[model samples]
Target: MVDENQLRQWGTKVVDIEKQALENLYQYIDSSEFAQACQLILQCTGKVIVMGMGKSGHIGNKISATLASTGTPAFFVHPGEASHGDLGVLSENDIVLAISNSGEASEILTLIPVIKRMGLPLISVTGKPESSMAKLAQLHLCIEVPEEACPLGLAPTSSTTATLVMGDALAVALLQARGFTQDDFALSHPGGSLGRKLLLKVSDVMHKGDELPSVKHDICITEALYEISKKGLGMTAVVDSNNTLVGIFTDGDLRRVIDADVNLRTTSIADVMTQGCVTITENILAAEALKVMDTKSINGLVVINEQQQPVGALNMLDMVKAGVI
Candidate 1:
């Protein structure tokens, strides 16, 4: 069994302590060393390598990902592995970001001499400015907090969160400096939802050429129904004798005609079809088309040309195929 009161208090205490740690980080942002550190990273010709051990290593990997996605070109390397062979990844043109709370991680300390020998720029993020990690590095970002969020004052919660946020700030600053756009973000994250939204186009998913269901305004209701079945879009465009769009017929209209006992063989599309149907231009984005369909409570749209003639068609299924859904 556990004390509910203690659990609740502990949760709140962690938030308060971590909040203060972040506030402290803000105060250190304007320090001259941060600017110098950013300049060193910005000027590096090779990739930025982030290295850490234990809890710091987890935060460092996320920082490395952020840097890479945001345009700084970075990757994480475990400090302990560098002693084996991973140190070969580092070169004279590269820069290293090493994070250690105590700034005295033995694995990291062991690599200091080799890193110096390679003459690679090293930046340190730590809680102790006086630790060996800070003394040996080219730049130091002190992330010290008076106490841990844990009641035991031993957990790495607040310190690790602060370091992670500081890493995010650095990555975003570089991203903005380089004017990295959403299009650029899509390049690396092509399998994700955001990439799908930015990379997909209307032409990639539209039913064009012979695949489009189309009927002239004077065409009989039976002919329109046949086109709908052949095209499998559940809808067909009704064009005038002059080859201009005038109306549309869908499954809903078929149901209404059946309920009215209208003769499908005798009734013309011009009379039974719904006039002034919702339409989308061929040039519009598929995302915009999706919004239009949603707002209009329609499942499909007739893609019309500049001459107001039916050129193509698409349904919600097309959006799914294009990855817009």
Candidate 2:
């Protein structure tokens, strides 16, 4: 029943309308009212409680999550639920961010007096600045869109997009003000790739003890090749008599020896090995190791301890498996 061409055209048109709607948010976010809202949230001693009804409630939930993840403590409470018993979640130290496109949602209006009684600061996000919800709140940020993307003009299209963008603007402004760092963001998202990159250390995902691919510096290239193959790291660490890393031999070294026509069975690894190779410490983050590998254009690294003793080994494969690459 659907024409593919018409459907494609409709999708493109909707995107254009919402894109323009987001573009229009620049003025509202730069307004003094937006600054006041950010100040109130930044100074709050307790959590931000976002309240809304229906579609507004959905956007409120997302806004609450974005704020919480970006160094602001916040959560969502439906206006209808607040009236029954959820208002217990509020306290004197808390601030309220209520969202209603029309600015006159009855459920939100009904909670205004209770919020005031609790001595909570109220911030309203609405399209109608003159509506009761905006007029009664202590701080108001307007999200007025030029037109809806819906052909029928009955659905919330551009207006909801504008509200979401405005919420993102507020969250980012607060994030910058607090100097929130990626490490702080990682604390809340430990299961994601960013967390792995930020939190995983070299010792946590490296081959240690007997698993380390190591050979004595005086060993023949053929013997070093056996160690590299057994350890499956495409390389081997060349250690001195005291088991301190003195050099490294890799597949690339093997290629150069072959090109020079040096017999693998007769040549000592020290003659062909690379001295003073790039190394990492056990306590450094895996991401730092990746950066070193990238800068040096290498695939593996030797992890050292405080006394410059080789304690572990890791390659790009380990970084990939740990989600750090």
TM-score of each: 0.88, 0.88
Clashes of each: 0, 0
Residue 189 C-alpha lDDT in model 2: 89
Candidate 1 residue runs with Cα over 4 Å from true position:
239-246, 256-261, 274-277, 281-283, 304-311, 320-323
Write down the worst ten-residue block by lDDT for model 1: 196-205
Q: Model 2 over residues 1-325: C-alpha lDDT tens digits?
A: 9999999999999999999888888888888999999999999999999988888899999999999999999999999988999999998899999999999999999999999999999999998889999899999999988889998988888998999988999999999999999999999889999989999999898999889999998989999999999999999999999888999999998899999999989899999999999999989999999999999999999998877788999999999999997
RMSD of each: 2.6, 2.6
Which sections of candidate 2 miss by over 4 Å?
1-9, 255-267
Evaluated with lDDT, which candidate comes out highest? 2
Tell me the lDDT of model 1 at 274: 90
For each candidate, the alpha-carbon lDDT, in order, equals 0.89, 0.93
